[model samples]
Target: MFTFFIALVCIVFFFLFMIGLFLTIKSAFKFFVTKSVTKKQLLSSVIGTFLFLLIFGVTAVPTFGNSSDNTKKVSKKSDGYDFKSIKLGMTQKEVSDKLGKPSSQNDRAITYGNNTLYFADGKLTGGSPKFIQQQVNQKNSNDKQKKADDSNSEKSAAQYFGSKSTQKLADQASYVPRTQISNGNMMYSETISNVKMYRIDDYQTGVTTVYKADESKDDGLGAILYQGKTVTQEKPKTTIVY
Candidate 1:
């Protein structure tokens, strides 16, 4: 946009200057070649040229001056990965091309400073969160998250692994859920081995959950029913291998 403005200004200014110069020279030649031209006509032509140049100079100086300041402001604003241009359903490659490489990225979302862009099935999702601000994708009920923490001791098992493939386990990094197992009651979670899994969609609230992995425990975790008719409540059972 700034480049366009610069080019436009130069073209318009050059065209106007050339036209004024041509008219002034033509009038001067008419005065010299023809005795019919008077002194007042010559003086009017000179004053018109001078006034035009003065007005153009006054306007052009401030225009170019403001252009420099505008460029600096735009350069600083670009630091946020052109957050204003970000839209829903943009591919990872498309976004990277516009914003350069993200500060950090995963299969789920790409982080740029305090901003994050969420993706699913390789396309950006709309209504995720406001870009260029701290991470505040609020969806979990405070009571539910607190209960989940309290129910599983201090940490919920789902807070460990980030699963980019499924909405349930997309928060925790460094590991992926082996599979998502439904625990009836409309609740679901992604399983990590046979030990623990994080809550995906809580049927109780019907809201989509985000990065919150349940803590892994050797006691087979808690109440996680892996593809069973009923949710299991048994802890990890130890066995002796003969």
Candidate 2:
């Protein structure tokens, strides 16, 4: 509606400018031919031309400026995710109500807790085959990470003499388990391993281990790191323990 109003205003101003310019030129030509150029006629012509140009400038400037603003608004709307109302743990229905249906759904899951929802345009679309595939992928990735940690723990334990020391070593070498959360536009990974990682493909920022569960205290190893490199690394390796 606002757009239509602005466009209508512009069209009206454009026609008015054309008419004013035409009259101004006609008056000037008449005065030149008759050799009776009156001050009043010249003033009227100048005023008409100035008014037309002024109106044209006014209409044109806002049109260009408002177009940029409208572009931003439309872009946000088309992205299928509203940043304002989104929150973690929102169900597919809730997200749909806020963002409407997704443009496309692929094999992706935006997982939180036991409830896994389909991911499309950074938001949860619904539960379907694509969602299931994403769940399987996540489970597979988690399983692989668990196995890796176990292997590393076992290796660390073998290097330790006593069983108590082995257990401690195993715990120390384990990577922090993370749960994925998103603003529908950005993904964040939270873990009790004293590290909070945020990832959007190659762009990542987070902190390193700072707390130990057994001691229930900070380990002073807490360090923040920003990954400026792209995350286009090779596909993750997986091993099935069974």
TM-scores for all candidates?
Answer: 0.26, 0.38
Q: After superposition, how far is residue 130 of candidate 2 from its true place, in Å?
A: 20
What tens digits encode model 2's per-residue C-alpha lDDT throughout 56-138? 67877888879989899976554434334644445656665765665543346543333345556554444433444555577
- TM-score between model 1 and native: 0.26
For model 1, residues 1-242, the per-residue Cα lDDT tens digits are: 99999999878877767766766776777778885667866775786587568657867888897998988897666554566666666888988888788888988888776567778999876423355222223323555787676656423343333223233333433354334345542323444434445444444544433333345645234543222122223344699899
Error of 1 at 216 (Å): 26
Residue 179 Cα positional deviation in candidate 1, in Å, after optimal superposition: 48
> What is each predicted model's overall lDDT from 0 to 1?
0.57, 0.50
RMSD of 1: 18.7
Candidate 1 Cα lDDT to native: 0.57
TM-score for predicted model 2 compared with the true structure: 0.38
Q: Per-residue lDDT for 102 in model 2?
A: 50
| Best candidate (score: lDDT) | 1
